[model samples]
Target: MHPNKLRAFWAARQGLLECDTHLSPETVLEQTGWARSVGGVGPYLTLFTRAGLTRPAIDRAVAQLQIHELPSARGCTYVVPRSDFALALRCSQGFGDAAEVQTAKKHLGVTDAELDRLGRNVLDALAGGALDPAALKDRLGDLVRNLGPEGKKRGVTTTLPLVLGSLQTAGEIRRQPIGGRLDQQRYAYARWADSPLPEFTLDAAAADVELARHFFRWSGPASLAHFQAFSGLGVKASKAAVAPLGLLPVSADSPLLALPEDLDALRAFVPPETPVYRLVASVDALLLLRRDLALLLDPADVPRVQQIGGLQDLPSHAIVDRGRLVGLWEYDPEREDIAWTSFVRPDAALRAEVERTAAMIREHLGDARSFSLDSPESRKPRIAALRAG
Candidate 1:
């Protein structure tokens, strides 16, 4: 398929094109895949850019148990809808404790029996009420054993993190931001009144198969390698996962795969004649899901990507037209404006989209930090580069 047509099909399927006013953030996430959350405003951008949802509405959904961040595929966190909570937790499995516990054992000689005991204590601490890490650690006292110098060197300062993580992935506890916002990471862990796992009936293999179903729907016309990478399921499990889904090739000689239901729709789809503009977060599913940057760019725009660096990844948040990337942008706090540079020549429509996104930032989402640690000082270089362009 032509790149123009290809991008539009992806954009519409990902809910980046014309949106209906009635759609909710939970519906947006269910229709598309979950929003990737990294203690940043990407989830806010993902919902607003697609469905015109406001920050308060998304935050309300978070508070009401309509959506939440959890350890999903690859043990990375994503803001998944309530309907998917069970599936997401099922996909996360052992990966939640894969690293920290192993390192603690290697460095501080921590044992599973010890960790198991600590997990119970952590749960007991939260049973009284939700508590931030500092407060919980204080309450945990001797139960939260310090790993000392050697453990700090290995990044396992205490037993608290290891147990808290294990309990969270196991669906016994949840982390909520203290401010009731999704854009920051200062969290209070609380015991779930109703855990998501007991309601999920699938076993391990069944969970993978179900995940493959969502994966292909979320990122069809994608490669087997793409699924493998997103899943982090390794070779044998990934093959087993997709096998039952009846994934098919777009053409006999083509290397791409698609869900059985999407092929006819993709064939019938047409790119809109007029540009449909949006400014999306760097981690938005449209870019991060299938992750083929060159395919989403026009040949004319290729140089703009090179101007920053190479196709390894985007240097900043993007300005998109019907899913094709037309520009790169970042928030400039000093000016209270969106700092942007376009790959295509700026037109009235494009400029309007930029200002609209800028004002939306000021009104609802606030800063556009890609992650929690990102700050205005750290963004100076990229802001300058966009200005230079």
Candidate 2:
């Protein structure tokens, strides 16, 4: 497939071209597999930009347990829909490698049996009701009080994280938002209610296959290595998972793969001649779906996008023009403003569109004050040149 066409197709698949009214926040998450929630804000911005969901609606969904934040692929926290929670968690089981276990043991100075005991204690504490981390730590008392000097150095009062991490991966418990804010990271621990969790009994192989299917549906025209990297599955496992789907190869040079059903659509895709712009979140799906940098960015601008010696250090948020990355943007909470820098000199029409987008951002920010056009250090020269004109 042509790279530009592939980009446009991806944009459409990501729900960037148009937001469907039928697509709820939960459905959006299910379709996209998961939204990055490491910083807590990414998932909210992602849903807002892609699904055209308002902050109140997203918060209500999360508060009602319609969507959940949990550990999943790549062992990172993701905002996953409740429907896929069980499967997502089940697939993440055994995700904590031996190295992590050993590190936990060394830090907490706890044996396997002791860790098991702690896990049991934690479950017992939360059996009655939800409890935030501080309350849970107090409830456990001496059991987790002294997590050794190593744990203290790490600024943890207890080794509850070690046990809780294991339980979360095993689908025993989950994190619930402390407040109604989408950007809030404070959470309370609650039992993983079997009533809400899906009962689809797919074995590891079947589950991995289903996961691969979802990955392709949302992030197709990708390579096997991309799946492996995103899913954190081994090369052999990744190949096995995607094999049953019968994906078609895009080309020999790229060796990209796509779902059979999407082949015709991919072939029919065409990049828009008119300039289109979108202000995307830091870990947006369109940017995260593929691993290859060359496909998304120009070779000359690669250095500006990535860090020294790092192949994949993208900006916190991107300013995309049509299917190409044209700039970067970030929000300053203190200043209540949007700070942006552009790589391309946008014409009057594009500039007006950008201003309209800024207005949308400002309105969505609720009480935020203003917007600015100052460039970061990396793009200072570019901004200066644009102004010099």
Candidate 3:
């Protein structure tokens, strides 16, 4: 498929272009295959942008267990709908737990037996009521007090987090919100009481098939490599998973894969003639769809977009125009404004679009005073120069 057509198809599929606001926040999350929230606020911002959801609504859904946060695909935490939790949890098995355990062992000198004992104790501690990290640690003080010199050297506080993660991975406990804010990361531990996790007997191959199906349904016109990259499933496993789906190619020459049902719609997709702007969150799904920076960013601007230390660092969240990333933006809490910088020179029309998008962002954030392209740092004279012109 043509790049623009593919981009439009992706935009539409991800609910960026035409959102179904009638659907509940839970439905939107499930349909989109879960929203990444490792940054704490990503999932809430994603729903606001894509589903037209408000922070209050999101908080309600989460509090009611209509949706939940869990470590899923690639072992990153995601806010997934409660109904799809089992499938997401099942698909994430054996992905990153071993490495985490090894790191804990090396740094904290925690052994498997210790972890097992701690896991059981943690369940008992939470059996009566939910407890936040600090409270849980206080309750488990006697249990984890003897993590040894290594734990002290690495900071003994790390032991509880490790144990909590272990129990979560084992599906013995889950995270519960501790505050009213949707963006708040404060969580208490609770038993996974909504429903029991699926047993291993539920056909691994079938689970993989369902996982691939859900991914492509929301993120189609993608490649097997994209699926592998996003889901962290191995090449052999990814191929086997997608094999039964009978996904269709976007074009004879393109490596992109699409669901057979979507082929006609994708072929007919047209990129909008007018500029379409969206303030996407850092590590948003659309940006994460492909790692090739050139596809989303202007080649010349790539160097400017990399994080301060290196290219491996996360790119700042972006403002996208017609599927092309045109600028970087972030919410500066102290200033209560959306700070931004455009990489490309804006035409009259694009400038108007940017202004309108900035207004929308400010209103959505409620307390945001304004949007500014000027850098907060005095040393960055170049950014100020861009703002002046």
Give the number of the best model, judged by lDDT. Answer: 1
For each candidate in the order shown, give its overall lDDT on alpha carbons. 0.86, 0.71, 0.69
**lDDT tens readout by residue for model 1, 286-331:** 8888666887899877876877766646869988898898889999
lDDT (10s digit) by residue, model 2, range 298-378: 567677666422445453466776556777665554444555667777677556655655565566643211112222444
What's the lDDT of the predicted structure labeled candidate 2?
Answer: 0.71
Could you tell me every candidate's TM-score relative to the true structure?
A: 0.97, 0.86, 0.83
Give me the runs in candidate 2 sitting further than 4 Å from their true place: 96-99, 106-108, 151-157, 195-198, 306-310, 348-389
Tell me how candidate 1 scores on lDDT.
0.86
2 or 3: which has the higher TM-score?
2
* TM-score, structure 2 vs. true: 0.86
Question: What TM-score does model 3 achieve against the real structure?
Answer: 0.83
Q: Which numbered prediction scores highest in TM-score against the true structure? A: 1
